[model samples]
Target: MKTTLATIALLVLVLGWTSEAIQVQENGLSFSLEAVKRLQEMFESRGTVQQNPRSRSSSSSMCEDPMLPQELLPLCKQRGASASLARLAMVPMDVCEICAFAACTGC
Candidate 1:
């Protein structure tokens, strides 16, 4: 109970201390609506850049690397869609795997 109360008191004190840093001064709001609207407007103003046929053909569909293992080719297909899986496929190595390979060499 005492520890919980101390934690709460510390949290309150830290929050109070950083209130100014986290809040907007003009209207006492955390975020400025104008800035958000401007960012939205900027994206809207720029519009979409249409890809040429050549660029479209060169996109993520070419994720299959000839150097990569055949089993990993399927995982590479979803590289853009799944970051963690893509990372795993790209770096499919570990200390244990290296040790096993070294043992197999009989050196």
Candidate 2:
């Protein structure tokens, strides 16, 4: 009985650690090389807009909106950054503000 209890305890410990690791990985931000390339392309196309004064206003607006992607919710929750993709909604996006927003909301 004692041995059985020890085995069970070990299993529980392993499972708990595994679950925590999985949660951390899932909640973390992971971008593939392809995604980075795509983001660079998008930023390049909107280079001029980024330089324009109007761009700041638009970026601020998007930063203010609250319709973020579901995947990003966790990161946002951890970071405590709020705001939606309202203004720069026009330009192709790459940065995941949703995670920061989610972190903000969670906090």
Please name the candidate that would achieve the greatest TM-score relative to the true structure.
2
Q: What C-alpha lDDT, on a 0 to 100 scale, does residue 3 get in candidate 1?
A: 100
Q: Write the per-residue lDDT of candidate 1 for residues 19-80, one digit (tens) a residue.
A: 42321111111222222233223223333112222232332333432433343344444424
TM-score of 1: 0.22
Candidate with the greatest lDDT versus the true structure: 2
lDDT of 2 by residue, 1-107 (tens): 99999999999998776433321122345332233233334434546344552444443432333543344344444432222221122223223323232221211
lDDT of 1 at 69: 31
**lDDT of model number 2:** 0.37
Ten residues in sequence with the least summed lDDT for candidate 1: 22-31
Error of 1 at 103 (Å): 22
Q: After superposition, how far is residue 99 of candidate 1 from its true place, in Å?
A: 10
- Clash number for each model: 0, 15
Which pairs clash in the backbone of model 1? none
lDDT of 1 at 10: 100
